[model samples]
Target chain A: MKDETDIQTPDEALEMAKKSRAAAADAGKKPLVYHLALPAIVGCLIASFALRDGLQLAVTAATMALLALVLWRVRKRGVWVGNLRGAVSYLLASLLIVLTLAAMFAIFWLKRTYGLDWPAAAIGAALFPVMVAMSLVWEKLRHRDLTGKMS
Target chain B: MTNPANGLEPLFNAPTRLQITAFLSGVAEAEFAVLRDMAGVSDSVLSKQLSALSDVGLVELRKSKLDGRQRTWAALTRKGRKSFAAHVAALQQLVQMAARAAE
Candidate 1:
């Protein structure tokens, strides 16, 4: 379509700007929405299992709360990390998934090798920190072009 | 009290275009994919609007390699930054006055 920026008068232009900006801002609000809910549910669920069946309910709740806070804090500051359309992003995502799976496997391995018999919840609790760390590192490395300090 | 809208650039007149400009205003520059998601437009739609924005010199679109990957990035020009600031101030004033009236 042709440029629609050539509307007749200032009033018309301003009105259009307001409407367009509102819509765009709404679309960009994705980070805030999922950052609020998903992190809490995922964090707590993972922590609950990682803590094994042995963690007190209060400790589990606290761990979940802590993980949720950490996840929210690590949210991409401006651009959406997931919107990246490069091979690098795909690599970062793959690395993150692999690391997470690896963390889970490590828990199983430790139980098998050392005869630890770690509970599922304890394993999940063990993986939480590693996952959170990987997420932050991956996001930073994922959009280094956007987030990296200007040279 | 100078006509705030007087400072409004005609280049940002289109709402979707305006939205794109607004998103670019906050950052140094952003990738096409990132901006497309922020603008909430289909790929072709955003490319068109971005070209329009570029034509008016309100935005700069650059294609380059980052971390061994090719990407298109957009940044608001100096003119765009000034124009958008004025527009936002005007909007804030309007909102404030409206709040007073409702109260």
Candidate 2:
């Protein structure tokens, strides 16, 4: 409640600074669903590989549609902490993409070589946890950036 | 060798304005109601403070309709972010100075 002109001591200034940091952190906070949605969508996309031909294409299309809808809802929330402007963010994104492709290839190889059943589904199930962890890391890094606390 | 106090901007001396800028610094943009809740300020108070920051080129405001309702969003300009960082650094410096003096 005190204005800057009213802050006469170090304690007052520190309090204001703390409040500012809290405000910044709060601005970046999102609903729990927001965090889980992306990983689930990616999981569906990966799982689609278990289907054949027409069904696979249909699943992929539906997954894309779901991804688009999630993105739209996030945008409508009026806050965007994931701006993807920094080098570290871009690096993380690229790494995820590469890892996803590698996982998909591994699934395909297993399916063709060993006659593994539901290889894509198995890989997708495994990937869900990894993607969730990465999503959490992404949120933490972005929040740090917003608070000017990134090291 | 520069004085940290010199980095502090007069506009952000107001706690409310500093809070607004700090919140905006963390995101691409925020809805007016979200900012109001975070800052714990009324709509009019928030509008006033936002206008002050906007007038000084520290913040940008946009009005749009979402779902058939009017809404306003606020974002910090590049200059605003620079200024806020400086203000925060200055505050930290003050706290450190006090701590050292106490020790």
- Global lDDT of each candidate: 0.58, 0.77
Candidate 1: the clashing residue pairs are A49-A121, A50-A121, A50-A122, A50-A124, A50-A125, A51-A121, A51-A122, A52-A121, A52-A122
State the displacement of the C-alpha of residue A129, model 1, in Å, after optimal TM-score superposition: 19
Model 2: per-residue Cα lDDT over A6-39, one tens digit each: 5545456546556666666665676778678888
The most accurate candidate by TM-score is: 2
Off by over 4 Å in 2: A1-10, A72-78, A84-94, A104-119, A140-151, B99-103
Which whole-number lDDT from 0 to 100 does residue B34 have in model 1?
71
Q: How does chain B score by TM in each prediction?
A: 0.80, 0.94
lDDT per residue, candidate 1, A36-93, as tens digits? 4443445455445444455647666775676766444433333332344247757766
- What is the CA-based DockQ of model 1? 0.09
Model number 2 iRMSD: 3.1
